[model samples]
Every structure is written in C-alpha cells, then in structure tokens.
Target: MDKPDQIPPLSIDEISILFFNRQNPVYIDVYDQQTYRYFIYPIINRTVFFGCLIITLLRPLSHLERITIEQGSSTLALELAKQHTLTEVYYQKTHEYFTELLEYRESELILTKGKELGLNMNSIMFVTLFKISSYQDLQVLEAIIHRLVSIIKQQMARTEKIVYGFHNKVTLLISLSSSDSDHISSITKLLDSIIKEWNRKDGPPLNAGIGNSYYGVENIRKSYDEAGKALSYLTEQNRPGMIRYGEIGLNRFFLNQKSEEIERFLNEIFSPLWSHKAKKNELEKTLLVYTDSNRSAIQAAEKLHIHINTLYQRLKKIEEALNLSFNNTEDMLKIELACHLKRTFNA
Candidate 1:
C-alpha cells in the first residue's frame, strides 16, 4: 500500500476504475522534486494511489477540481457536526443546574456547581426575563438569542451574568458588584440597549421584567419567582416595558386576586353604571376623572373638556345612580376605591 504522501504510477484503466467505482475519494496532485514531474493520485479510504498514466486519459480537470472542493466541504461539515453534538451535551448539563437553582433545591450543591462553572454566587444577584411578543422559528429565535446573550455577557463580564433560553424566553441571572447602588437603573439601561439592538435587527419586540436583587445563591429562587411574576403582569396588561418586582407595590396585591373575584368586586361596586347600556363607560370615565382631579368639579370638567355645570350634573347623576350621597365621606371612599380598581384592572 502506498503512504498518503506517496503517489505511485498507474495505467489509464486503473484511474477509470478508481473514479467510477470508489466512494467519496479525493484527487490531488503530488510533485516529485527529484524528477520534476507532477503525478495525479486518488486518496481513497485513507490510502494514496496513482491515477491515470497519462493525465489526459482521466476525466476533465474541471471535474477533478469539483470533486476536490466537495471533499473539503464534507470534511468541514463533519467537524461542524462534532461541535454541535458537544454543544448540545453542554447545554443539557447546564440546564439541569439552572432547574435546580430556580427551584431552590440543594443550595450547597448548586453553589458548588456555580463555583465549578465560574459563577460568583456571593454577589448581589437578580433574575430577568425577556419575553418576545410572538412565536417565531425556533432556530432563528435561538440564533438571535445567542447573539444577544453574547453581547450581554461580553458587556457585563465584570458583573457576572449568565443567560439562557428556555420556554421561548431569554432568562438572565446577573450579579452586581458590592458597590453597585443603582442596580435597577443599571439593568434597565442594559435592557433598553438590548431591545434597541433587537429592533434594529428586525427581531420581535421584547419586554423585560426584573426581580429584586438579593445576596447569595440561596436567595436566587426568590428573585426568579419575582421576575416571573413581573413578567406575567406585563403579559396580562399587554404592556411592553420593563417592570421591577419591588416597584409594583399595591398593584401586586390586586394582580394576585382571581379574575372572577375582580369581576365580582367591579360588578358590586359599579352595578348602577352597568345597568346603563349606552353610558356605562362614559359614566365610569367621568367618575375616574373626577376622582383623579381630587373631586374638584372645575378641574374634572376642564380635564374632560366639559363645562363645570355639566360636571356637576354628571356628578349628581352618579350620586343618584349609586343611590348614595357624595356628602357622605364613607360613600365617597367607596367610589374612590372603585375608580382605583377600574384603573388598575382596566374594567
């Protein structure tokens, strides 16, 4: 057998058989410096051997060149397959760790894994969820997410951040240095930049929800839950903006209530307005404007683009419809509460 670097002489019949009968063979030219001759050889199954005795007896040089290029492409494809397999395995293992961290299970083991993965669990950490507006091709979305993650990781290297894509959303667990006081502001700026980049690239619109930052790996689950809750609110409200868990305040209390419960409360409070088919929304808006204007008839009318006397007339109708006098502070309080509920729940 000839070595890979050696090319032996052959007859035209042998070259014809090699080209037609061999499977996936590479053709190359070998130069003999001593004899100053160029030889054509076929590399088949890891063995090098000569082709046609006269180069012209073989197929056109163009055909041979095409085969050589195809061989190079095949080799490149094989290498890429190997790399993709390795990446899938790595992602599986990392996903397991992520699941455990989010569940708050085996804190010590997760912390150890974090250490092995070069994550700093001692820093102040928060969770953020970036939600895309609609479904897209998984591969395309993943490519976009990978690019965004690479950019964020590169920019936030000093902050110790980890990003993952799961359930059609990109989740980021970022840590801040001890001296970082404006954590929410910093993350908001980062998200704004990311969203701008995504928009520039014609990607789906993205909304981000951030959780409160806490110290230590054990508290990561709390942040994750908070982030998820914040994301749910953003989705339910159909609003595209960043919301922090801590900033929701009293709205969180109302959001936690069941839809049925909220509906029942609204029905009970606004039954009189509900009875009016043509003017329910109009009356509700009037009440809301009045309440927002601190019950000042002039200001409420001005805001609503109505006359002061018209505002008083509407207020009187509201009082008669609810069968309660606004002079009674308790009744006024109930109306104010109803207005708040309406504004918050979009009822």
Candidate 2:
C-alpha cells in the first residue's frame, strides 16, 4: 500500500497516518441524495476527482473519531472528527459498497478525533475546473486527477483545484503557490502531465490557462482573467495544451501595426524579391548590401559575390516591383522598417 505523502517542516512522530499505495484510491460515498466518489491519482502530486461513492463512505468514517485519507474527499467530516469525539475513521479503498463500514469498525473513533489529523489551515490551495468534450474520458480522468491532487495536498500542503468544464471542449485552469517567481513546481508538474496526456489522446487542440498566485477572493478572479487571456492568445503562440499568464505578457510585442499584419509587411518591404521570385534570405541580403554600400552598386555587387551588372539587374527588378526609384530615401525607410519587423519576429 502507498503511504500517505509526508507534509513537512515539523515533527510528525505521534501523528497517525493511513496508507493506500497499490493504486490510486477511489471511494464511493453515498450521501443523502448523491453518491460522492473521491477519485485519486498522483502524478507529480495533485489529487483530482468527484463522485457519489466518496460521499457515501466519508459520511460514516468521517463520523468516527479520526481518519486521515491522502485525498481531500473526506475532509469535511474528518476535519471535525476529534473535536466532536468521533475520530475513529480509518482505511483507504479502491472501491465497493461497504468499505466505509469496515473502516468504522477498524477505527472505532469518529469525526471529533480526526479534527487535528489534517494540516488544513496551513494548506495553500488553488482550484479551477475545465469543461471537456467527451463524457467518456471524464470517468477515466477522475481517478488520475484525484491521485494528483492528494499528493500535492499532502506533500506541498497547498490546496489546488483544476476543473474540466462540462461543455464542448476540455478547458482547464489550475492555480498553485510559488514562493519564488522563477519556480512553480506544482503548477509546472500539472502542466507537464496534462500536456503529455493530451498528446497521447490526440484530440482537437487543447486550450488551457494557468493562473498565477493571488491572495484574496478578488485577486483570484484577476488570476483567472489572466489565465483566460493567456488561453485566447494560444494561437499566436501556437503549440497548445498549456499557456501561462506570464507568457501572455510577452505577446504585446508581436501585435500587428497600423497598415499591415507582420506577414504582409514582410511582403511589401520584400516586394523587390517577389518580381524576381527571390527567397526571404536573398531579399534580406540585398537590402543589407545596398544599405551598407551607401547605394553604390559596385560595392554592393562585390559584397554579394555578384558582378556589378548582375546587381544592377536585381536592383532594377526591385525598382520595377515597388514602382519607385532606388535613389528615393522614402523607399529606403520602408525597406529598413520592414527588415526591422522581420528580424524582430525571427529573434
């Protein structure tokens, strides 16, 4: 059995912990009107899941003196276990109807005893859900998500929520705490797992947003907004399945300008090449040579490893395509600006 992940920074010698290794635990808890199932699968360490099976089991066990499960599903009752004199909840399970009953008999305690069992208040948590395309995949992902969150909630001791919306597409947003701006271990791990899974599934493009840290309820909405913007700009950045708010901040430098898109601007400025059907690098070379030579064909020709007559012929083609004289300073400015934009995109 896999032991509960250790949450660090203090002595835990006397603390009682339950183990559930072999596989991710999926508990079926039947509540008054719902069957709550807590699905657990740990990747880097984030447990994600939801269902009726979990609610059913948690109700009875959590009423015991104290039970500590790796995942958060039973926390509601277990949190109050010891304080309420019902702290004897115990054991984790894979599945089935009466697991909670066995746990109750084994624990011999109730909710009151389990109050101190969890490291709840100190936990920093971020949660968000995505609406996905297929309901079929939902069941599959449930246990995996549960296991992932359980690890983070136990080890990192920070709570996180990643939801898959119940819409046409699978949209996900996860929030995590990082003391340093440079490192976000939990969030990065989630992204890696999610991306890998997306690749394996190979469905329509996966659009995702990752929210940065925020302190209060109000700030959380901002983080979500940032995540959404980051997601929308995925096309500009291309390769999907992951995008960070910070990445969106870097996109402003790429927006189109007054008269043309970046691609079209490259065309107008490289217009000379279109007439001769010359390629991108060739057009760039010609401009650099002309600019460096101070409009001297002889010097430019030598720089290009071409005869002066050949250089003259290329320049004539450019002039004809642009319908402007090579000697015109205004035309030179347009070429220079276009080249600048082109280089900016390349770099």
Candidate 3:
C-alpha cells in the first residue's frame, strides 16, 4: 500500500466530494471496487489525498443512504482530518527538501535538511533524468509526471529511490546500498524498461540519461549535472534511448565545447557536402564505416553491404567534394574527426 503504483481504482464518477466549513476539512466519498459497500472519509486536502485513503465500497449509493452516511460521519471526519494533517505537512517538507538539494545549496545546510527529512545521504547514489518534451498540455503533463513517479517507485520498490518532477523533466535520485556492479546493472535495466514503456505510450517520446554513482550527499549535485550533460548529448545526437554519462566517451569533451564552436568545426569539415540533403545519412554512414573499418575498403564495403567498387566510387565523390586526399595523413585524420563530430552533434 505504500508503493506509488498501488493507487486504488477510484474513478472520478465514483467520487463524491463534500467541503465542510468552506474547505477547512474535505470529506471524500469513495466506492471501492474491491468491496461491495460504501465508505466516506475526511481528508485534509485534495492534492495529497491520492493513495492516502482506504475505502470499502462497490455499489452506487441511494440518495438517502448518502445523506445518512454524510450526516453520521461528521464526528469521525474531525478525527481523520487531524491524523492526515501530519501527512500533508510531511509532503510539503519533502518537496522543499528536494528543491533545496537540487539547487546546490550549502553542503551543511543540505545535510541538515536531509536529516530532517529522514533521507539517507551517505549511501551510494546517482541521478537519472527523464527529459520529456514540452509539447504536452499542462494538466496532461502533470498527470504524466505523477504516473511516471509511481511507475519508477514501484519498479524500485526493493531499492531506495527518490523521484521528483519539475517543469518538463523528472529527476530520479536512486540510492544504492552498495556499489556492486550487479546492483547497478539491475537498476539500469529497470530504467531502460521504464523508458521503453514510456515511448510505447501514445504521447511524446521519452529518453533517459543516467549519471555515474557516487557516495556521500555532496556528490548528489555532481550526479545531477552529469545527468543533464548526458541528456544533452543524447538529444543532440537525435536519438531516442538512454545514455549514461560514462558511456558517452570523447563526446563528453565535445559537449564541454561551446555549441557555436562545435557548429563551426562541423561547417568547416563538412562544407563540401552541405548542399547534399538527399545523401546525407547515407554518405555520413559510408564515411564513418570506412574510417571505422581501419580504412580497409573490403571491410567497409562488407559492412555497408555494397560492392568494393561502389565503396571506391563513394570515396571518390567525397574526395572530389572536399578536395582532400585519403592518402594524406593529415587529411585522412581530419575526415575521420569530421565524420565522428557530425554523427555526435548532428550539425
């Protein structure tokens, strides 16, 4: 019941809301799908009430039955409201705690807040960012965030995870009991599954970028930064999938370079074929495969599923356009670098 995904199937139509004393304490009447009776409960507020209530009811209620229950529940309502106040306060505090942590406040202050929230800060942890498109409607986006947080919490029920949403992004702070590779692999696979499921839905595409794990609370900000960097790398590559900060390799250095600089380099190297929109992917793929194959025409041809003569012909066209020779060491290295940069930044 504590898991986020365990929300009861309470439909909007099945809910009857009553605001007692002008919204000071709200009473919710729910018809539980699993039980064949009705239950009326008082909640502190609407925003934090989901998954916080337990109801037992199945059938629709008669007008008289509803009134009788509402009138009789007044005494119980006050007691429940008092109990739920603490929960509302806890959520507000937790939200503030995460906001401060992500904002890179003073380390000592962060540690104090972590202790207050009962969060373990000494464990091995990393941050993973789920970058969603901003095209979704505001209400729909909020629902998506809530659903995603629930799914992630449910998936990592055995592990320690903190899921938070801000704007169009969802930040996942996962704490590991140990730095074992097996634990990392299992969690990574779970995140990959989540991304795949998200894309399978009918809305915007989803991508994940994971940062490396580190110990201590001070490195939480570092992990978050790495996650953002990895996400930028993934987006610029024009791909849909998860990318880990450690996996991006030399592209990490490229990311550190200003975007304008990267663009300048791409334009300089690819000036010859800038006008060839039709053969861009095909030609880029050809050059990359050729360079990656140790400049072996046979191997490159085999990989590209083309005849060696065809490979030679494409190389000739590339050389003519760039006015560079493959035999020149400097020119060949420049070509290799250009191909990689073009693929990485998609400039």
Query: Which residues of candidate 3, in runs, are more than 4 Å off?
Result: 1-92, 99-118, 237-240, 256-264, 271-286, 304-317, 327-329
Candidate-wise lDDT, in order: 0.68, 0.44, 0.69
* TM-scores of the models, in the order given: 0.68, 0.39, 0.65
State which candidate has the highest lDDT: 3
Candidate ranking (lDDT, best to worst): 3, 1, 2
| TM value for model 3 | 0.65
lDDT by residue (tens digit), candidate 2, 186-258: 5567555655564455433455666665543334445555665655555444555666666655353454333
Model 1 gets an lDDT of: 0.68
Off by over 4 Å in 1: 1-88, 103-109, 199-201, 260-264, 267-271, 274-281, 325-334
lDDT of 3 by residue, 187-256 (tens): 8998998888767654367778899999977688889889999998888776677989999987898887
Candidate 1 residue-wise lDDT, 277-313, digit = tens? 5646667778889999998888899999998888888
**Ranking, TM-score, top scorer first:** 1, 3, 2
Query: Model 1, residue 93: displacement in angstroms?
Result: 2.4
Root-mean-square deviation of every model: 14.3, 17.5, 8.1
